[model samples]
Target: MAEQWWRRPVLVDAALAVAVAAAVAIAIQVAGEPIERQADFLAYALGGLMGAVLLLRRRWPLAVLFATVAILLTYYSLDYPGLAPAVPLSAALFSAAVAGRFRWAILVAAAVVVGGLVARVIEFDMATLPVASAVITDAALLVSIVLLGETLRSRRERVEAEADRRVADERLRIAREMHDGLGQTIAAVNVQAGLADDVLDKNPVRAREALQVIRQSTKEALQELKTMLTVLREGSETRQPGIDQLDELLDVARKAGLRVTSMTSGEPRPMSAEVDRTVYRIVQEAVTNTIRHANATTVTVELCYAPDSLIIEVTDNGTNTQQGNTSGFGLTGMAERVSALDGRLAADFLPDGGFRVRAELRT
Candidate 1:
């Protein structure tokens, strides 16, 4: 229900300019001419109208300048000094400069001053010294206004751009942390839960072992989450995971009932953090999808590392029933995550009545 600042009226400026213009025109008419004359009456009215237009100088600066200039030129040519037209032009020049168009403001100011000076000199045969001095003063004032405006505009734009970059960088950092910390913790939990389920009916000792692993995994996950929150609040942390942890990740998935086969054909090398994480997440999500969606008795995950690319494939022999799929945000989120790393993810029903998901990330 709050009104926007931009929509609010800036009436004070317009009102002040109009009042000044009206006073000037009234004073001139009272001293030098009869107020009853049509010319004097029209001059004062036009001057007040042109001055009132200054209120819109910030929003429609160029338009305001041209309109004010045209009105003033017409009134001055018609022999009426009622509208002190120079004020609107000065406001517009300053606004334009602040909006980061200094060159344009300077060009307009130059044209106006030069033309006004030439016209006045040729028409009135004015002395060169005074006319040149006034023109130079006006030109200098316009230049100063424009320079000030440009400086402010540049500073504000830089601040906004820096803020945007920082926000984006923070989001990316958070995303990587969540992917590694939460994903690994969840994988360990899944492994222990599976082990517990398998031993619940037969061996009490094995079941307790699984439960202990689950407890440890949960504790680690909590610590990671807490660390993440702390980093979010305080903006510093020394603990971070990298591609070196991929083996432990695979071990966790293996415990959870996925047969993961990882091989590096190329020389072990470093990759960008984004690409490394993308590879890890793609594999993780693919394996998770196999467990959740494939009712197969066996799932196979393969990771092939080449010189310039990492290929990952998750295939399951379980033929999950082709029932109505009412929920699948994980796959959608996975696709988005992969695309953000400039990779492609493909999921489909295998011709052999199974499901497979594949992704390839360029290092």
Candidate 2:
């Protein structure tokens, strides 16, 4: 208990102030001063009392300032050199300023300087220099300290905001990938299963084939989902989704219902995972939109690979309900995803009643 109590700043400051006061008292005694003088004893007692009260500066800054001011006034009035308690006074001022009450600190600082000046002028002493210097130095130091604290706080806030933005961006990208990849595959499976169910009694062999395709499509989707999710949930930040299985993805769409015709141009080559994933995603979304929104039922997906870029296009005959409450969020999400990858995406409604989506990803 004793060790912990002494470790506290308030307790340590109080102890030091008391020690200085005692030293001052001893000096006065050694100067052959009359100890029996009532005024002299009273001054020494007031110094010790004021120093003790200063221990509570952090807990009660205003009270500490009030007590220190009173002590200074009493000492100056009585001309008691042994009662000079500048240490406690400075500590009280610093504590108030650090407590984030700058206006109050300024008011107290002004009052101290003015009162000290008035007292010194009355006493006709050279002590005014020390008092004035102490007041100015303490105020300046306190102001700088507070300003530094605020600056660091602002910097921390900015760093936190940047971190939040990065996280949000990553999450949005993940959602877009999941939607473009898993969403399309799942939708195809649903369509194939529904068709098989309707045709099972009339055409057993065709229905069995459709069911097989559905099973294979869903299994592939599961594998792709696992791979993408693993990259997202763990490993290095450089990990990305790529299109290593484009043929299988397209086959699933073909089996669903839409007569999808796909053609690849230029020399096929390996590309960056991010770019590959983006190509697959754009095609997947385009195909899904064709299935869900088109009426004429014929869809074509073309991938024109050039030396520097890959061009993707999906066009379908429009016959579905175009004016219905459709979730256009998928289109909006696709645009955001493509832009992040430095790609361009465009969607158009044909005057002849068809829809088309074109995307170009630069290498």
Candidate 3:
């Protein structure tokens, strides 16, 4: 991904400084004013100094603007020429606007506008239509520069907000993944360890199978931990679960004594990686909840893919209630994932002495 525009503050400000200087030099030359006091050179030196100040505009925007305007206004007060006002003043206004201090920027802008108009009135022998048009043009230029800066400021803020939101979402996702994957795997290991201990002498083979399950669960848990760490370091993961993992998921539940079954309908078409992973997570979490809390013997995972949307349902005939699962993001994380994709999640308890977690997902 490309870096944010504001990340390299020096480079951005420097480029802007150079552009402003070039444009101002061109404008001053276009006016064709005589160099009586070497006013053109003075405009160059003074405007160069002003543009140099723009390099630090973001740090002290109002100060930079005030200083630039003060210097320009002083030049106008000396009655040297009219070439020093528009370019430097417009640059200052833009810098202030970009800084997002609208109140301060506007205050400075108002002062600069009034100063520029007064300079125009004093320079002219008479306030004719041409002179009035010049003043209006300067005012328009002032508004336009500040408007551009304000627009950019708003855009930068929006981009930053979106970036912050994405970061928060990703952190939540990693947390939820660890909770679901590691939490369930560890729970399964605990259950199997207990089972192995219970039947160690009478049922040696069964105990060995339980031990095997525990070993596998720990390995899978390690893999899940690795995935989360990879995401933290690289901001991405490759081992995302998909529809293909449903059978293995159900098998794991069966091994954990849940007697889970899975069913799918409609032609399974291609889905985005994110959607696939999220679907698998929802299923995993649902099954894990059933194993840990449902106290039921059977859990069912069903998937129905339509032309437009996909529906997932995980139900258990366990009498274990799920109304007050506020310990962690049990269903809350699933809801966030669903909401991000503009999907719907209904994870309430069923009335028929069972619990159900259902989600309808969209691309």
Candidate 4:
């Protein structure tokens, strides 16, 4: 996969370094300044090298800034004419501020620019209007660089935060699928296996039928698990079952010795992919629980499409029994999916000895 631009901040920093170096070199050459016995050569090389040091700006912002400032000061003290103070300092100040070293950048700015202004004041007799103007211009330019860097830094931070939130949301969605869809399929397989075990001696024919149900349930579960993994790990598009696949789900329950039926009402118009898939999962989980926990002889899965809403209902006339914890992630996951769509899920145990699951989604 192609790397995101933000993930490669160092590359941008490196390019900035090369640009700064070239700019500094061109400025000195154009100034027609006198070289102080090869001291000018030394100053140019060191000043230009400060730009390349920006490669570590994010890792060592304060150090890079201090190093650039010290090198520029040392270069000027070599007595080279037309040596500008803010030439190399610009890149360093920008790098530091953008690296989130606000305190360090501020401290460096105060120490350098404020100190320069105070020195000019002390030398008032020798400092002309031109000198005062240069000092003010240099200070203003440094502040501008720092301000621009901070602005970009804030934008990058906001981008990163948004990316993190998206990742978290995707994770939650995947978790719900695993719990509601795959978990119920596995549980159904367990139910079939246990039934086969119970009937092995009393009725060999019935035991074989139970084993067949287990095989089919596990096979479907494996396929669904594979799809879930593909979606999460590879980020590849995987097919999600929807209302069209409701008959297949009911077939599995029928084959497992449960009387289950599916029917649709209203002129069935198309639903959004998310809403369609959520409807399937809700019904699937309801059916699985009916067979596993509710000793139901018959269960009904129905879909109703209204002008403004899509409704789904799963009902079973069976005694709701529990071997252990009756509550599971099935209902919670369904609720979460419906809530995401601004819909509602109603799942409850009927007082007359049955269970019902109904979901209503806005069109």
> How many clashing residue pairs appear in each of the predictions shown?
2, 1, 0, 0
Root-mean-square deviation of each candidate, in angstroms? 8.8, 7.5, 4.4, 3.9
lDDT of 2 at 237: 62
Tell me the lDDT of candidate 2: 0.70
TM-score of each: 0.55, 0.64, 0.79, 0.81
Could you tell me which residue pairs clash in candidate 2? Answer: 295-319
Report the lDDT tens digits of candidate 2 across residue range 181-294: 688777777777877998999999989988887888888888878877787768546455456666766776777777778888998898877788778777778777766656
Write the number of the candidate with greater TM-score, choosing between 1 and 3: 3
* Runs with alpha carbons beyond 4 Å of true place in candidate 4: 1-19, 29-42, 77-79, 119-136, 226-238, 321-328
Better lDDT candidate (1, 2) = 2
TM-score for candidate 1, residues paired by index: 0.55
List ranges where model 2 is wrong by over 4 Å.
1-133, 236-239, 264-273, 305-310, 321-325
Tell me which of candidates 3 and 4 scores higher on TM-score: 4
Candidate ordering by TM-score (highest first): 4, 3, 2, 1
Query: What are the clashing pairs of model 3?
Result: none
| Model 3 agreement with the true structure over 1-363: per-residue lDDT tens digits | 999876788988898788777766665566555653445577677657767888888899888888887777655555454564667778788888988877776777666667656655775565677667876776778788888999999999999999999988777777887887777787688789999999999999999999999998888778778877876787565567788877876777888888777889998898998899889889988887877777788888999998888999999888776532846777887888898899999877777877888899996
